[model samples]
Target: MALVIEGEERISAPVDKVWAALNDPAVLKEAIPGCQKLEMKSPTEMAATVVLKIGPIKATFQGEVTLKNLNPPNGYTIEGEGKGGIAGFAKGGADVTLAADGDNATILKYAAKADVGGKIAQLGSRLIESTSKKLAGQFFSTFGEKVGG
Candidate 1:
């Protein structure tokens, strides 16, 4: 099944600082919910291992993430596909935009699309949808709290 999610958050930092933190592997590892390992391969590619729990099921996902559409302190598109062995696969992408909320704050917005298959999808749309939203929320909240934002 496919899911669409959108939200915005204001960070107490400049747009450039927020953008740099977004691209930094260490910051991303700390900000991303359930992220266990993250390695940057190039300026725009990363390898990640994340562990997630949904309802009564738990799974570890190995994924490769890629960043596209460079716009400097503005926005970019991020995509990733992960394999969870017998639990199945999940793939998604998001278009993220950033704007200045003020001279010292930035507003970050995202329009994300995701899909899951196999056992993960069998958990029902409602469960998956809620979990996805929760994960996204956790990431952004952690991000906002870090990097002085």
Candidate 2:
């Protein structure tokens, strides 16, 4: 299965602050709804564990996430690959852009693409797309609250 998601969010914080929040493992761990762990191995590399449930199917995925194409207070791209044992695997990336809105505000936009294989692909595209959107919505809602607070 292949899926793409694109959206924008307005944050009540500066671009630099938003960028910092994005890079902080603690913030990520808190913001990702099903994330179990996020360990930063270096400035641009990290390992993560996420548990996802789609209807009757549940899977735990372990992955390495990388941040690249970074431009401070502007934008960056993140890519990751997750293996879900027999359930199969997923690989994806997102391009995130941040624009200053005011002294303490920023607008963020993201374009994401993902590919899934194995048992997951059997779930059908509509199901996968809906689930992905739900997860993305949850992630951003949590992130916005955290960053704005």
For each candidate in the order shown, give its overall lDDT on alpha carbons: 0.92, 0.90
Candidate 1, residues 49-126: lDDT per residue as tens digits? 999988877999999999999899899999999998888899999999999987999999999999999899999999
Worst 10 residues of 1 by lDDT: 140-149
Q: What is the TM-score (0 to 1) of candidate 1? A: 0.98
TM accuracy, model 2 = 0.97
Model 2, stretches more than 4 Å misplaced? none
lDDT string, candidate 2, 39-92, tens digits: 999999999999998656799999999999999869899999999998889899
Top model number, lDDT: 1
- Clashing residue pairs found in predicted model 2: none
lDDT of 1: 0.92
Give per-model TM-scores. 0.98, 0.97
